[model samples]
Target: MILKKHLKSIMSVTLAVGLVLSMAVAQPNLGMAASADDETYSGKTPKYVFMFIGDGMSYPQVSSAEMYLGELSMPGQITPEQLDFTKFPVHGALMTQDSTSFIPDSASTATSLASGKKTLSGVINMDETKSIAYTPITEALKEKGYKIGIVTSVPITHATPAAYYAKVANRNDAYGIGKQLAASGFDYFGGGDFDQKTGPKGADQHIYEIVEGAGYTIANTNEEILALNNKSGKVVAIDPDDYEAALDYEIDRADGELALSDYVAKGIEVLDNSKGFFMMVEGGKIDWANHANDAAASIHDTIAFDESVEVALDFYRAHPKETLIIVTADHECGGMTIGYSLTGYSTHFDKLQPVKMSYQEFDKLVKEYQAAMPSDPMLSDLADEIEDAYGLDINNLSDYQSSMLEDAFEKAMSGEKPSDDQEKVLYGSYSPLSVTLSHIVNSSAGLSFTSYSHTGTPVPVYAMGAGSELFDGFYDNTKVYGKLSVITKLDK
Candidate 1:
């Protein structure tokens, strides 16, 4: 798991330069100083804008990833490690509450981020009443002739990406969302396939047909996606191997597989124009991993998300003055904490390195095992599998830990439903054995989760390049859209 040489060099140069600047100015190397004159930022607009959303990311998620990388790079010692977006020249915090409650889902939070307005949970780009649609900044920019691109590790029509264009009362209306995506006429759309291409009941028009009829070239294979260039015109590129679901987690990604960074890099090539462009790239599966309470999987996805930010940073370096990059999250998920009671005050993030795949992937392994075995398998039967997948030594488990897994294994084997309360404590709607295994492994690494759902935590925002100073103050998530509006001079 060596860092790519080019990305490593980019990070080194940025860190070195930031250190020198900090020494020269006698201030912390966190962000560039804001000017006292309000007029200094007026009428300023970036020609190239990249907005990166690490879905379900917050301080805990970011810090754990940094610490994990630090441990990997320099074991047995404490050292500062930073992800690329964290090195930006502006830093801020965002309150994630929505109209419905303090704790929010992606639909509402993303709506506030995109439209400068509040909405009920599960609503997208509309007011709480859902009667009036709010024009998001992406549509505004598109109206002004800037090419727009939407990319995500999840299906394009998912809540976060849909906030940019699709307006729906319910986020689950994937068919309706797909129609809006086609009507968006945005320059590029790349990610997983539509979550629901033919409506929930399979009675609606195919999403692919709508997109093609709207003049988009669909690229569903690696070769087709790779061949897409600036001249490819309007395109929709999905991972050919996993067309129906999210791209694989970074920990599970294989050699030559397409990644979030690859999509962002391709987006820049296709969206670049004289009038400039705006690209929204989402690390969508970080949230999914977090929801499953898989620390190793979430950490790896967060790292992959940072690498996607690095792609934008590379672009920023080439067009420093004209480019603006903003990185933030919709909300925090999993209530992930760095220290666990079992480990007391010490954390050993390096312990997570041995984990080989995501809980989603491991669940598949469980299914395969069940199908192949002639008889019911015992907890002992999965020793080698558990060791290989989660770095757990089943034989070494304490009696209490062993008991918990044994009970879960029995429930999994019986194929009987557990009570809702039991489900929450044991699996939270995922495969029972998989969730239990992650809990065991995470505790070993001094990591734990408070809940298997979203938390009422505010997420951090990082910005650099043109108009980045405007993002330096703490605020509600709605102000994100306000700041971008002011930066780009979007009409109210």
Candidate 2:
């Protein structure tokens, strides 16, 4: 009896100890659990990083663009060849942006990506107090002996492009930005003209001259850009103002004038040196058109932006493991939403042609229409002209649709609003027909568009090559800067 009792007591004690250990393991401390998942990433350091930012591109914009393109293909089907950046081996989403306010403007978001720090809205490469941030990826890359370049469809002094190089309290300080750009000592910079030479005569009327004097070759045409011998170490500036004439297309409506892809090709040509390079190519105008709710213009610009991605992908294919390419957007513009099935879903987007109207062309058309009707300041005449340009039939428009357009136009003409439904209809919103077509394409091609302005939502990020693994999960926008910095050895 004494032996049995001793054995039983020992068994009870062992069971009690086992239960205590189980409880301890089950209620692990938060810090310990976090540490358990923390992993050190080991991979080849990226020799080249190509970042493509499609300004104002939201998830909806990409989907819509894809659907639109797919509609143009056989049986309204899209293939790998039709995709601009589909070749990226790894893909994920990025937070749209985070500023002092939830809806971040381009200046803050771009600055965050460039400097690895968040700042107030409208600040570029500076903090909330307007002090320059010390950790710009460009500076970091330069410190590590990597060549750096920036290209964009909008003015080089625009927010997204300038954020990479210039520091300023306000993004509108284009003159100061331009001066800084000339002195940045970067190898390549190309884009449209900002109001660079707009002052009164002799009031420093030569910003291009300033750029040229700063050791850049100012080429006004693609031919000039093409003529540039690879041996020249000089910075090349393509005069975006004159690209249309050189290409034999009306500057007002030309589809390709210093296109993002073309600029990317040129950037690669110049910056692809022995030490490797870091290039940021932005389709900056997508946001501008989006803000105006110009659908045709925005979609066309998105397509152009995607073409630039194709250029980077070409480089990626050639370089394979040596290159890292990331395609993403700063934010979504116009609060663009994609679809509502009630609008007759049988139509597909493949039927529409890429819009060809330039801002100038639309302006000219509007003025002409206005001139034709002196008695009526209303858009009766202008509406007819717009219908002709866009192939719209007034008969098909519902009373509500017509009234909405008329009101929008009148407000625009009275200067109460910017240009009205002309800008919106031709480029911004899809008419019933267009929307129906979009749905059709979406059904077949897996594409569609939503809002017409930037949303508070996060955008997607598609990455490929070495160091791309770092971008696999949810991260702050500034973390992209750090990763790029480390990959390019900019952290040195």
Candidate 3:
């Protein structure tokens, strides 16, 4: 009704008319096209889109990261080599149920992938009878002037980047989705940092002081996002430091930090401008590593979200007729299946690369060893630190994985109150020793899991630049908002 009560004043007058049509065009050096035949592709009108997703990705989490990157290829590569958004040209498969539920949460499948509208289940872009809110392909391309990024590895007000600029009816209400993502005067907002970043406890205003009093500009390390440029101003990096310090589990990041394709190449170097930007990224912890079934941290967060879908397919081969992209997901968590029953059909995905880290960093290494030995913490001294962070072979366990880790270490040292079969094998999760050591190293690399949550399975979309043949065949994820509202032309 009247654009869902002026969704925060239509993002403060569409970023004040996108800084006067981004200072009248002309500034697209988009970089990265040195040699895919020195690229150039032409098609127009899509005017730079994107819209990835991946929160709980499926199709067996993209064929289990293309069979664990084909067992980490390169020694005479016979296979395992399709990533960069699963080599899309066009592909389809959706049907992620939700209006109430059919296993779909990530705020009702990210508000039906940002306002294609199907609502319910802790709505965000409101609609399944909440008296109408919908209109969210980034606010219908912010009234056609565009420019509105929103990357995510998690927590840019969660629920899949707050369903492209909040309209909250309650997706965990992080202080009212951090005041609608600090008044969403949109331009950018990379992920993580705010599940409660100074809001839930003794709250006296501090979502970083209302996202820096709404003027924006808050990067977060990697030297303040590589000393941002591209006429920097309205930003929101948030590369962790609270909200469980996210942007993690790209096989547990280190060194400079900030990854999720460095927040989509710093959100395409500050939303590429010239009235054309509608980003959306996500890869949101591949649904918290399939809610802890953790197939090698959801295949290293789906190959670190295919390095931001190969940085938006190298800016759609340098604006292939004004970009389009797409990719997909928002459903199918641990129904993930890649054949296993102790290797009946064989699938040694390099034994999930010794699981380096993440069952949320072994659930913060079991609360840092129960706060350094809480009155003597020891589940076989943390099961020998999960067999040295998952190289497991726990002296080759498999008498049903050492009797389910000795009945999960005598029901986690008999703290009592946990028997529904020890709450479905360990406090229902938050790292029960990295989910019993990554499901016994993903059942010794043949892999398995049916549910810890989310699964009505379908997810897989792909697509490519301009009008991607309106997302070929099989539909329903609200027809990806009517084929991205006719490839973002925005007349609807």
lDDT for each residue of candidate 2 in 254-351, tens digit (9 for 90 to 100): 54455567778887888877788889988877786666555555667778788878887888888888889888888788766555343444444543
TM-score for each candidate, following the candidate numbering: 0.90, 0.79, 0.35
| C-alpha lDDT (0 to 100) for residue 271 of candidate 3 | 80
**Model 3: clashing residue pairs?**
43-321, 44-321, 393-396
Candidate number of the best TM-score = 1
Can you write out model 1's per-residue Cα lDDT over 1-492, one digit (the tens) per residue? 356988899999999999998788732111112222232356458999999999999999999899989999989787748898898879999999887878899998998888877888999987767888888889889988899999999988899999998999999998899899999989999887899988899988888999999999999888999999889999999987673467888898999899999999999988877899999999999999999999898989999999999999999999998889999999999999888998999888877999998888887877887888748588888788899998889889989889989988887877766677867767887788989999988888899998888999999999999999888878778778767877877653
* C-alpha RMSD between model 3 and the true structure: 21.7
Question: Which candidate, 1 or 2, has the higher lDDT?
Answer: 1
Sort the predicted structures by lDDT, highest score first.
1, 3, 2
Off-target runs (Cα >4 Å) in candidate 3 are 1-37, 53-60, 63-146, 157-192, 195-207, 214-276, 287-323, 328-337, 341-343, 346-398, 407-434, 437-461, 465-492
Better of 1 and 3 by lDDT: 1
Instruction: Arrange candidates by TM-score, descending.
Output: 1, 2, 3
Cα error of candidate 2 at position 87, Å? 4.0
Q: lDDT, candidate 2, residue 466?
A: 79
Residue 262 error, candidate 2, Å: 1.2
Clashing pairs for predicted structure model 1, backbone only? none
Candidate 2: stretches off by over 4 Å: 1-41, 74-82, 198-202, 239-256, 340-355, 358-360, 371-373, 376-384, 412-453
lDDT of 3: 0.75
Of the candidates numbered 1 and 3, which has the greater TM-score value?
1
